[model samples]
Target: MFEHIDFNNLLATYGYLAVFIGCLLEGETILILGGVAAHQQALHLPLVIFWASLGGMLGDQALFWIGRYFGARLLPRLHRQQAAIERVTGLIHRHPLTSIFSVRFLYGMRLVGPMVIGASRLSPLRFSLMNLLGALVWAALFASAGYWAGQFLESLLGDLKPYRLPIAVGVVIVVGGIALARHLRAKAKEQHKA
Candidate 1:
């Protein structure tokens, strides 16, 4: 049933939208996939970066706005996050610009940091500017990582054409596993708290 689908064609047709939406939901892996597609000439690298950057910035921006408007009411529900929240708040107090600019690069903080900043009542314009800059850098780094990884793998394997489906499937599985793990951990924490 799966044999008919051409991964390259799929990527070429919907790669940009996939990258944008993926970055919006969970960034790094999707950007890397986009880069891999670009390396294959199924998609353009610059446009991948562009879509990634835009999606990343808009995602953070949305989180920031959410924080600004509803954070006070919303934060109390996330009791398990007190420590991380406090740490982000402290970072915002001490190094707001750095925190904002570097937030996306930080592991768990990619999503939370912007919210913390917004909740802190930091300037919206400032967040937007730094978020834009950070998204560009973050997108470039991850996308290039994907592209270069393909290069390295090609050097090692002698051919990538046959491995495209496996590579994509592997990426999806790994990303899904990580996400599931995080979700389970959060649920565990919630249950433990209860």
Candidate 2:
């Protein structure tokens, strides 16, 4: 699996498309990592940002409609994850804007937040505007972080170009896996603690 996906080459060759797909899958980490790749000259910055933001908008837009259309019906089906569902519902009830945008920063929330909003009675137009703004800001932040990280790393190591791909993949896999594990572990702990 790892051998097949060449991060640097892929992002460099297919920045926007890759970003779009990443966003569609709610792969914010990959999107942000692509930004870092952009800094490496392996990818184009503007293209990365454009695709990522577009993907985010489309993904969230779809979710909003899902909520608007099937929210009530789906609520019962979400019995196992009722707490999370309710949290999102509360988010929609209380701070809809924060629910729409800030969820992008959260791994699990990214997927559920939009769906919850879609499930709620929030206005589609309002959701669209918030989703777009959030997606753009999120894309800019991650892309910039990725690009600058590349530059900073290059300067720090004095010659990261040679080991760039290996280093990048290593970092991506390690950090991403760690974060995921931590999230899962925390969730598990919460369940047990609760």
Candidate 3:
């Protein structure tokens, strides 16, 4: 089943969609992969960044509205995230603008930060503006990092065409493993807190 599909062609055609969708949820890995693809000329760097930023901003905006309209009802259902919610809430209170702009850069806070702010008394316009700025900066930074890594790997390998597939697979496996480990650790911590 996998052999019939050309991975490179698929990425070239649908890379932006992948980046957009991936960034809509948890996105670092996807954006990095896209950046690597761009470095390999499988995708355009600027378009990748644009789609990623849009997706990131839209995702946060949706979560913000959800929190604004349904936070009270949503809170009890998010018992596992109670600690995170509280922390973000406090940050928003103390430093509303900074917190809004910096949350994307902070680990474990990406999803919850905007929600917490929306649930607060912060203005919608303010959140939107800051969210856009943050998303763009975050997208550029991560994507560039991935591109740089690809460049370094290419230089180290001396020639990448012969090993591109294997190298891509290896990178994916390593990143996936790391993400899974982090997720498990976070879950364990949440359970311990509970």
Candidate 4:
């Protein structure tokens, strides 16, 4: 199934679009993949960062507004996120700026953090500025890691042409594994509490 797709062509045609959409809804993997493509000269690094940041900021902002307008109505539907929301709410009350800036860095808090802040008294302007900064930093950090990984692999393997798919698969597997582990741990904790 993977052998037929032309990655170079795909990246050339839909790279930015993919980055934007990906970042709009869970973007770390896409950003890292874009960075790798940049290193391979399939996409531009700066463009990748721009699209990723824009997407990330837009996504968070949308969620923020949703929480702002309908938080009370939405809260009950997000039972799994209650704990994270409460944690972020406390942080927002105590250190609003820091909470806004650092929320993107937290593993499970990325989505809920903005919502909780929006449900709080933080202004849209404040959230926008902080979200932009956080998105940029997150994009740059992850993209650079992807680029560096490509470089390291190139140095080690001597040619990345043949190994790109394998490397991509490896990254996906590792990330998916981590996500799965976290999900299971959270589920187990929920069961224990129950």
Candidate 5:
């Protein structure tokens, strides 16, 4: 059923939107795909980065707003992430700017860290500014990784025309599997904690 899909055309049309939405959650995988699309000339690298930055910044902002406005009511529900919350709290206390700037890069803390920061006493304007910078860096870094990866593959395999489908499928499956595994693990951990 999927054989007739023109990846290049599809990506060219919706790749930026995908990158934007994908950056909202587990974006690394999708952003990488965008980068690959850019390498394929199916998408533009700068636009890919732009959309990623916008989406990432807005997503974190929304989370931050939630934490700021509803943290008192919401935090208790996240007992499973207590350790992560505490770590983020400690970072905020010690280095507010650094914490806000680097939270997205920290392993396993990407989603929760912004919310934690939101719950803190840090200024919203400050958080917004820093979050923007962080998003830009994160987007550029990951998207570039994808772009270079395509280049590396091309150098090794000559032409990528024959391998696009397998590569795309493999990336999606691997990313999905990883996301599902993490979700299940976290769910089990929450249950165990309860």
Candidate 6:
């Protein structure tokens, strides 16, 4: 499967939908990587941004509507993870609209925020408008950042095609290790609270 779908082909085929699902599922790193691929000419920048922003907007809109219709039941169904629920609740309590846009940076809340807002009785039209704006901003930031970063990396790795896999693997391993550590720490905190 991996060999069948190379990066360029994958982006060309599913880049738009990937952005949508990424936003719906709160997959930022994946989305950013898409932007990196776009920078590599595997995808078109405007189309990438358009699709990403659209996906994000639609995902939030769907979640918001679900929240509006489902109300309190939405929270219990959407986020079973206690810590995430608590964090989102705290954010919503402290800063309604700000939390809506800002939480895009947070993996857990990126998808869940719209639902929570919907449950909280936020107006749908207003939320949709803001959500679209947020999606545009978020997609642009990550895509541009990833594109530039990939460019810098490419420059640094000039004529080093053979080392690409090793370097990529090393970076993934290091980042994955850090993520695992954070997950463990968060789990420990949750256990302590329990």
How much does each candidate deviate from the true structure in C-alpha RMSD? 2.9, 3.0, 2.3, 1.6, 2.7, 3.4
Candidate 3 regions with alpha-carbon error over 4 angstroms: 1-4, 159-165, 180-194
lDDT of each: 0.86, 0.77, 0.85, 0.87, 0.87, 0.70
Residue clash pairs of candidate 3 = none
Over the stretch 1-194, how does candidate 4's per-residue lDDT look in tens digits?
87788888988999999999999999888888889888998999999999999999999999899889888788768988877777788889889999989998887888888888888858999889999999999999998888888888888998776677888888888888988898889778878988
* Worst 10-residue lDDT window, candidate 4: 159-168
Query: Residue-wise lDDT of candidate 3 within 13-109, one digit each (tens)?
Result: 8889999999999788889888888888888899989999999999999989988998878866887677778888888988999999998887778
Model 1, span 40-90: residue lDDT tens: 788889999999999999999999999999889987777766656787898
Backbone clash pairs for candidate 4 read: none
What TM-score would you give candidate 1 relative to the actual structure?
0.88
lDDT by residue for model 6 over 1-194, one digit each (tens)? 34443555656788777766776666455556666666667677777778778877787788888878885865786434656767877887888777677767675466566767887886677777778788889888877876776677779876433443454465457657866887788878878977
Residue 3 in model 1: lDDT: 76
Order of the predicted models by lDDT, top scorer first? 4, 5, 1, 3, 2, 6
RMSD of 3: 2.3
Worst 10 residues of 3 by lDDT: 159-168
lDDT of 2 by residue, 111-175 (tens): 66787887777778888888899999999888887788778787877665566667667767876
C-alpha lDDT of residue 34 in model 1: 88
Show where candidate 5 strays beyond 4 Å: 173-194
List the pairs of residues colliding in candidate 1.
none
Q: What's the TM-score of each model vs. the native?
A: 0.88, 0.84, 0.88, 0.93, 0.88, 0.78
RMSD of 5: 2.7
